[model samples]
Target: MFRSMLVAVDGSDIGQKALEQGLAVARAMEIPVHVVHVIQTAAYPALALSDLPPPDIAQQALLDALYREAEEILAGAERTAAAAGVPVTTHKQLGHPGAEIIALARKVGAGLIVVGSHGKGKLGRLFLGSTSSYVVDHATSTVMVVRCEPGAS
Candidate 1:
């Protein structure tokens, strides 16, 4: 008894797999699929510079690049959903990815949220932080975490 499915994608192989799986479920349930890509932005300590450009300018440039990348990722996901004959809507958000995904799921009234895990071990997750873990823990809706195998789609 799901109304809508939301898939959070970040252009990774695992993310694509999650999208595919989410689409399949949505199709079977005859529900709409909404795909979201989040561009994570964080404040960085100012770099010590001798007569260099302003840090704000550098940060803005980096943010621009991230937005462009987010568009490309969303476009690819849109194409995949279209090819599967599944009508889909997409959203691009700027914030912590896990938080943004959960926010969108709630905003869209999604019955399920599908995301991909990078399969990083405990040590790796400790260093890199885990978006899937955050989503699984914080999301109000049901979450499906797709684990990506090495060299497999």
Candidate 2:
């Protein structure tokens, strides 16, 4: 029943499970899979210092590194999907991971959005935040959360 499936991957074990599930669903439905990795920008406080170069320069450098990492993550996802004989496209975005994934799902007209649950307990999530929680809460499209327990393949 899905026209397209969007998989949000981050190179984690849980993310790998999500990719596998997304690919499986896409393959069964004979639909295309869109793999997306978001480069979350580090939050830095604005500093007013005329003597030194702008902080944006450093931020840009960090972003470049993150972009490279994202590309690597996407490449691995592509390979997995390819090995599974699933049609796949990859995208790299810069912003909040949950928001970007939702936006891309909308843009790509994805019938399903597949994501991995980190399995962080409630207190941990309360302090560290959770992307899957955000996506589940904010996304309009159907979402499937694949939960991979620690030490389980």
Q: Can you give the TM-score per candidate against the true fold?
A: 0.87, 0.88
* lDDT tens readout by residue for model 2, 1-153: 778889999999999999998888888789988999987753422332335465577766865777789999999998998899996899998777899999999999998999998788799689977889999999999999999887564
lDDT of 1 by residue, 1-153 (tens): 889989999998899999999999999999999999987753223332324476587767876787799899999999999999999999998777899999999999998999999888689779888899999999889999999988564
Q: What is the lDDT of candidate 2?
A: 0.86
State in Å the error of residue 55, model 2.
6.5
Candidate 1 residues lying further than 4 Å off, grouped into runs, are: 43-55, 150-153
RMSD of each: 4.5, 3.9
Question: Clash totals for all models, in order?
Answer: 0, 0
RMSD in Å for candidate 2, one decimal? 3.9
Candidate 1 residue 139 C-alpha distance from true site, Å: 1.2
